[model samples]
Target: MKRISSFAFIFVTIVPFVGCHTSSQNVLEKKVEVKLEAKNNSNASGLVKISEYANGEIQITGTITGLSANSLHGFHFHENGDCSDNEALKAGGHFNPDKSHTHGKSIASTEYSKQHAGDLGNILSDENGEAKIDIIIKVPSLTLNDENKYSLLNRSLVVHQDKDDEKSAPAGNAGKRILCGVIKS
Candidate 1:
């Protein structure tokens, strides 16, 4: 009986790690990279890496430097992947494939009740003008494949000059675009 209990415990622990990828519906190895660009006189640059996990969650991690130093800046994924111009308008507006998208938190009552799929809120830089973001988007709103209209592939993430209130209509009036990056799979 003791041996059987120990075996069960090991099996349970190892199962998640071994069969995790097979259990998910999306591609686990699919990843996107956004190389940030500094707009105008702003001093900010970084690379944001986005990947899908086994639990249908999106994982974003990266390092940014040359922010306002200990300040909060709005960050989000924008439609279009082109960052060829200065104003960053080449990247289009916030990524909202559906008209039902709103401005709210990622975890809202319903899929369309919250905010734009691209709305990722804010990231605070340390006093050294550097910010490191490592967050797991637990919501199923973000996807890597074409099955979901909210797929983050071929998009670009733009950082604003100010903090996002997370309540304002559209994009929370997050000020000017300080940096932008194209999301490539």
Candidate 2:
């Protein structure tokens, strides 16, 4: 009986410590890259990287090329990760997990609840048809953790053919989806 009790105590103590260590590993920094592909025969392709910073801030950085020179294009995250459609319509509309807010500009100044969580504003291409993406805004609703309801994993990243008016209803008057990529771990 004594030997059994000793083993039981060791198991109880060691199991909790092992569990805590495993969970801590999960809280570590996570990073994922999405490879944007051309849609509708558009010449837009790029590699976008999403990473979590020290202060729990998530950043998106990358470069897109083959865009119209000196032009602006709408960029956003969609509800689905499927980009198999030629027009990328399978990705569905902007990711609005809350389903309460209207479409609005996703900028640093915009309130978190006022804009759709997936509204990422625009991407501007330079003279060489390349747009360097470096968005480090504070989007509290957007997270990398899959357990969070507002998580961006397994979603679709889409590039529009035109600019986002930032005040439109459903979508910001952004043109057809020209490029698409799936955000994954």
Candidate 3:
């Protein structure tokens, strides 16, 4: 009986490791580069990398150069990927996950519903107009394919002059739409 119990324990532990290795090997990994451009020669560029995990874990990194230091900027994914001359028009709208109204509020707001799908958080730059952002986001409703259902592909990243006020009107008075980019796969 003792021998049988020990064998069972070993098998249970070892089996999981084998299963994990096999599962890890089967997962499809993808990388994408996003080029950010300043609307009025703001001189800002950055790269965004996204990795898909099985448990809704998305790793994002945004490294920007040529920005104002010690300033708070609103960073988010816009509805459209268009980067036309008009940065405001190119960015489309904020990224609201709950289909809420347009508002530049905190990410923890309960009111101001019906928001856009790309309303992320803020981006803080360093003294030399550089900001490196690394975060893990949860996208429960996102897939790896491009079907226009809250898809990140062909989406634009917009940087605002001021912080988003989650409950305000017409972009929460987030100031000018300075930087824009199109997320590509």
Candidate 4:
């Protein structure tokens, strides 16, 4: 009888705690942290955190270092996650799941159809060669759900040598990829 009462008390104490903890954790179901790898001798490295909210808003925040001081670098999402190639060619082109083949304005653009779904615009580095990223993408199509065609997971984030011109045909004339990081949940 004592053992049964002890088991019941323990179960009662832990069950509610676990339930409450899981319920609060469900707020951000899709959150991933990616570690960047340097390419093309750019010597850049960073940690990026991507969080998907319940309302379809994606928040990306991180800090990249070893970039050109006080300069702008083009940052975009690539279709492929492979970064084996030194030039980052293995990552493929920008993620344009929306069929917006044309490279239009980047994150600043309000029209989703005008730009590639992965077009994140330029990230400026400070004097210390560190670029802090804090951007919220309000696009519904770019999600973390594995079933979605436009899911960002398993994709690659590429940092370019130059700033995105925002009007170039193929990839905004961003030059060669200098850093790459695969996004995962």
Q: Taking the tens digit of each residue's C-alpha lDDT, what string does model 4 give over 45-133?
A: 99999999887788889999999899999899999988888999989989888674578777545667667787899999999999999
Model 2 residue 132 lDDT?
98
CA lDDT, every model vs. true structure: 0.80, 0.87, 0.68, 0.86
The runs of at least 3 residues in candidate 2 whose Cα sits more than 4 Å from the true structure, single-residue gaps closed, are: 1-28
TM-score of 3: 0.73
Tens digits of per-residue lDDT for model 2 on 1-185? 99999999999999999998876552337889999999999978999998875455677899999999999999998999899989999999999998988899874457777887888898999999999989875765567876466888989999999999899878899999999999888
Q: Could you give me the TM-score of model 1 versus the true structure?
A: 0.79
Residue 179 in candidate 3 has what lDDT?
Answer: 82
Clashes of each: 2, 0, 18, 0
Q: Model 3: per-residue lDDT, tens digit, 1-185?
A: 99999999999999999998887763435557677777765777777676666665556686888778877788777777788776557567776545644665443233224455465667788899888978665555554455466667777778886776555665666778878887777
Best by TM-score: 4
Q: Estimate each model's TM-score.
A: 0.79, 0.81, 0.73, 0.82
Error of 4 at 127 (Å): 0.8
List all candidate RMSDs to the true structure.
4.4, 9.8, 4.3, 7.8
Give one digit per residue, the lDDT tens place, for model 1 in 1-185. 99999999999999888797666556465677778999866888998888887667788899999999899998888888887788788888888877677877543223545666777878999999899988677666678766457778778889989998888877778888889988776
Deviation (Å) of 159 in candidate 3: 1.4
lDDT of 4 at 17: 97
